[model samples]
Target: MKKKTTIYDIAAKLGLTAATVSRALNNNTKISFNTRKLVLETALEMNYEQNKLALALKSGKSYNVGVIVPRIDSNFFSSVIRGIEEELYPKGYHVIICQTHNQENIENEKINSLVNVQVDGILMSISNANLEANKGLNKLLKNKKTPLVFFDRKKDIKGISSVTIDDFKGGYDATKHLLDQGCKRIAHLSNDRNFEIFRNRYLGYRQALLDNGIEFDESLVIETQSNVQDGRRAARLLLDMEAPPDAIFSSSDFAALGAIQEIKESGFNIPEDMCVVGFSNEPFTRFMELTTISTVDQFPLDMGRKAAQVFLEEVGHTEDVKTTQNIVLTPELIVRRSSSKK
Candidate 1:
């Protein structure tokens, strides 16, 4: 007796992805005609059957989903999970939360474990660790035929659905607000440029400066991880510069708060002598007793819910019908005492 042929076997023989072979067999227009013809010829040569692996074919569904995040402690990530739970609970789905703590190894382990357990789907916010060479995450998921959705911090790969806010607009709005306050020299505190969200925010900041006739100074842009200590250290460095900025826009709310503390300790008044802005709209940003920080709200809860919705839409559909969708929500700027000089 001979074993049945599978798309994985075909993919391995052709040095291509199983997904590409499946798409070609389904006559997906996205694949080039030459590639499709080659795939069809190979399928006929190998006597391959047309039982394409579909999400609906999976039996004994555990009705469980795994959500991987960098850390669960952040208000943003936690709130997004809360939203995911709220949307999934009514559908008789259980969510297993996994934290990577920004480590790629832990992330890979969690994803592998989830796939082995045959979870129906996975939702994740990718880590910033450079794992492009590995290419294990997407391959594992696709090979397992499990659906994937990304919320918040996501990879920009094709074929994966994602829900996120317009980070560029968020950054632009944050900087524009500070410029509107009549601050001429502004500094930006940013994080790793490898992450699209952080990079977009920084780009937005520079674009805002350029739009307002302010020169883009790389010296004024300090790479801060957006924590309190990082913010304080960054503020100290900016103040020591020959020409210090009177305004600062940070990619992290916690970093912005740290900068505020450092500014005050150094004899600068908020929104008077030095204005500050931050991202993430962390709850503390709006609840300060003396000074509240102004920041951009990424709508993490809504992002989570939308991501769950994307999963629901894709689940139980054939691979031929599972089209990738990208959803971007709008971010709102909440002005407060920190940067609102006017």
Candidate 2:
């Protein structure tokens, strides 16, 4: 195996002390510009690499941040990760991503693993399951004094900061749009009600109905996963009702796609017979051209960037003086062909 070159090797090659080489590498103002330049050149020529772990141990900073998401394949999470990387990479920080698949146990384990590795900070979106029950995981992160930032999905933890959008307003906009399109009975395809995001969306839907003087029908609401199959099943159940809904406000684009497929199969002309709207504005929503599904533009990339900025700010402060922040980005409603009647 080839031997890895170190700062000591570079120092010997340049006839300088290892401390001098290190200071040069770190861009210490104490080192002369000419000496720093020469040390850098020698280090490059000798293929010398600085030990990050050793440096972290000395400075009490790993320069590594952990990001936890429910799933990476989704467009929202992927875009958020990209935004985070764009912001943190320039600041000499490495991001470690972990997916929990919306499982609380997996989320707990990932938090523990990241904490055990002594990561400088953690950014996460809580899963659909109740996070308050996972007190142990929260305690572990708190004990380690690691900065925690939640993006999109969050919990009401005292010390943690969060970056999210107004989901209630998003839901209200979607439902109100459907009502304007002459949708008298609107069905809702919901996810787990345990999380505040989904619950707020459901509340928005209900409030929109009430504000419009439309009687809220409990039968029109169906619980579903954020997938096509569950969406199809939910739609079928709604269709089987004696008075089926004239529109559907789904919490997921994937579910909306499934509902669209089932609706078409049942001989319903979209926008004429039934209108639909979905959340998140997933990529597939545009490709299908199913309906002008009014969706919430969560500004995932911005969310990620803001989350990284929060981490940077918190990490710079002393543990005792750290302050929590809750940044809420405005969600824009993108009206499309699926939900537009006029």
> What does candidate 2's lDDT look like per residue over 50-112, in tens digits?
788888988998889999999999999999999999999856689999999977788888998
Scored against the true structure, residue 331 in model 2 reaches a CA lDDT of 83
Which residue runs does candidate 2 get wrong by more than 4 Å?
1-50, 141-144, 289-292
Model 2: lDDT of residue 90 = 58
How much is 275 displaced in model 1, in angstroms?
0.8
Model 1 Cα RMSD, 1 decimal? 13.5
What local distance difference test score does each model get?
0.87, 0.87
Evaluate residue 1 in candidate 1 and report its C-alpha lDDT on the 0 to 100 scale: 90
**Candidate 1 deviant stretches above 4 angstroms:** 1-59, 129-131, 134-136, 141-144
lDDT for predicted candidate 2 compared with the true structure: 0.87
